[model samples]
Target: MRIATWNVNSVRQRLDHLLGYLGAVAPDVLCLQELKCTDDSFPRQEIEAAGYHCNVHGQKGFNGVAILSRRPVEATAGLPGEPEDTQARFIEARVPDGGGEILVASIYLPNGNPVGTDKYPYKLRFMDRLAAHARQRLAEGATLVLAGDYNVIPDRRDAADPEAWVHDALFLPETRERYRTLVSLGLTDALRATTDHAGVYSFWDYQAGAWQRNKGIRIDHLLLSSRAADRLVDVTIDKDMRAAEKPSDHVPVRIDLR
Candidate 1:
């Protein structure tokens, strides 16, 4: 099966790009983040017409996420251990693959800009909650694929100019340490597992000619649980999507599993 994740930025604004991606890539399962719309306002009709079942967890104008699968899915909204957190940033689903099923999550982790503010703490707390949840799920022996825009630069090599992001929330030492803690829990970063090559990136800024200079970062990712990692075949960043008209700053990252 092929699974892919993309932030899209805003689903309404990039509907055409999304449709084109769906037609071209045709992943068995697709996890989407930053939908920027309500569930009722989601373009379900258009997506369904394209032959995917939609499971959306959406907010009005900020964070939102969804799962689209070629096969029917059973979905759960919201990340566990955060009943007070109302942001629609997470959605998990059970997708059938052959005779078994895999758990897939669409996650738009907090960007946590302006490091001194409350946002950074919230981002760290969210990571803690996510790690706890992942621990429980893995203990249960679930084959899991946590795919999305993590809003993290896991390593210096992930960024074109690492110094430029030294003061940024995404590249701070605390942030990367928490990311490493999560990965230490037996999750294989699909791309790094495939290749150690630098300069491979999944996102570029829309301003300052970032894409033109190849100043990009590999933040969008698919982290697989040990059982799921065992089936991993290939991983690709759909870099061309960044060059499309009205393109999202982020592109898709896809993984193939046997």
Candidate 2:
């Protein structure tokens, strides 16, 4: 099966780009983040016509996530251990794969900008909650794929100019340490597992000719549980998507599993 993740930025704003991608790439499962619309307002009809079943956990204007699968899915909304957190940032689905099933999550982890504010702490708390949930699920021996825009630059190699992000929330030492803690739980970062090559990125800012200069970062990810990782075949970053008209700053990261 082929699974892909993309932070479309805003589903409505990039509907055309999305439809084109669906038709061309046709992943078996697609996880989406930053939908920026309520569930009822999701463009369900258009997506359904493109041959995917939608499971959306959405908020009005800020954070939202969804899972789109070619096959039907049983979905769960919200991250466990955070009942008070109302942001629509996490959604999971159990998607059928051959005779078995794999758990897939669409996550839009908090950006946590302006490090001194409450947002940074909230982001760390959210990471803790996610790690706990993932640990539990892995202990249950589930085949899992946690795919989305993690809003993290896991390593210096992940960014074009690492020094430029030294003071940024996404690249702060604490942030990367927490990310390492999560990975230490035995999740395989699909891309790094495939290649150690630097300068491969999944996002480029739309400002200052960033894309033109190839100043990009590999923030979007698909981290796989051992069971799923055992079957991993390939990982691809669809960088061309960033060049499309009205493009999202992010591109799709896809993985193939046998």
Candidate 3:
């Protein structure tokens, strides 16, 4: 099955591009981030009419997520982090594909910009929570696949210039360490698991001529559990989406699992 993730930036603004990509890719499961819409305002009918079931966890105008599936989606759950945290950053569902089940989740992890700040602390704490929850999911022995915009540059090679982001939250040592702790729990970075190329990226900033210069970052990712990783066939980044009219800063990343 083909599974994918994308941070659309805004659901309403990129609806046409999103529809086009979905039609072109035809992934079995699609996890979305940064929907930036409310539950009532989500274009469920439009997505459903395209022949995929939409399970959405949306908020006002910031972080929101959704899972679209060609197969039956069941056992939906929201907020693997905490109820007190109360951010529409996570949504998980059980997708029935042929003989087995796939636990699919869409996540919009916190983008803490400044390094020494309250938001940075929150980001670390959030990662801690996510790590704990992911470990629990790993213990369940299910084929778990978590996909979305993590807002983290996992390594120096993930960014265009490592020294440029020395003090940025996403590239801070603590942040990278926390992210590493999560991945160490038997979760596979599906893209890196497939290839070892540098300069391959998923996100580029609209400001400061980032896209024009190819100053991009690999913040968006599809992480697979050990069982799921064993089935990973191929992974790709749809860089062409970034060149579309009224494009999102982030594009799509897909993984083929068999």
Candidate 4:
């Protein structure tokens, strides 16, 4: 089965791009981040009409997620964390792949910019919660795909110039360590695992001629559990999508499982 993740930036602003991607990619399952709209305002009809089921975890105008599957899915909204946490940044669903089912989640991990603020602490705490949950799920022996815009550059090779991002929240030492801790729990970074090439990136800034210079980073990732990794066929980052009209700063990443 083919599973994909993409941070559309804003679903409302990229409906056409979404449709075009669905038509072109035809992935069995698609996990999306940053829907940037309420559930009621989501273009469910449009997506559903295209023959996919849409399970949305949405906030008013920030941090939202959705999972779309060509097959019937059992969906659960929200990441398991602080009960008072209201950010709509995670959504999980089970989609059938032949005789078995794969658990897929879309996550828009907090960007955690300007490290001195409350946001940075919140971001770190969220990673703690996510790591705990991931560890538990991995122990349960599920074939899983925790896919999304992680808002992290896992290694120096993931960025065009590592030095340029050292002060950024996404590349901070603590943040990378947290990400490493999460992946250390038997989760495979699908794209990196499949390809050893450097300079492959999934996000480019909308400002400062970043894309034009190929100055981008690989923050969007598809992390697969051991069971899922065993079936890994390949992975790809749709970098060309970023060059399309009115693109998101991010692009799509896909994984194929046998």
Candidate 4: where are CA atoms >4 Å away? none
Alpha-carbon error at 157 in model 1, in Å? 0.6
lDDT for model 4 comes to 0.91
Q: lDDT of candidate 3 vs native?
A: 0.89
Q: List the residue pairs that clash in candidate 1.
A: none
Where does candidate 4 clash, by residue pair? none
lDDT of 2 at 194: 87
**Model 4 reaches what TM-score against the true structure?**
0.98
Question: Which runs in model 2 stand beyond 4 Å of their true positions?
Answer: none
- lDDT values of the candidates? 0.94, 0.94, 0.89, 0.91
List, residue by residue over 2-78, the lDDT tens digit for candidate 3. 99999999998999998898899999988999999998999989898888888888989889999988866884646
**Inter-residue clash pairs, candidate 2:** none
TM-score of each: 0.99, 0.99, 0.97, 0.98
Q: lDDT by residue for model 1 over 1-258, one digit each (tens)?
A: 999999998999999999989999999999999999999999999999999999999999989999999999999999988789999999999998778899999999999988999999999999999999999989998999999999999998999999999999999999999999999999999999999998999999988999999999989989999989999999989999999998999999999999
**Candidate 1 global CA lDDT score:** 0.94
lDDT string for model 2 (193-234, tens) is: 989989999999988999999999989999999999999999
- Please say which candidate is ahead in TM-score: 2 or 4: 2
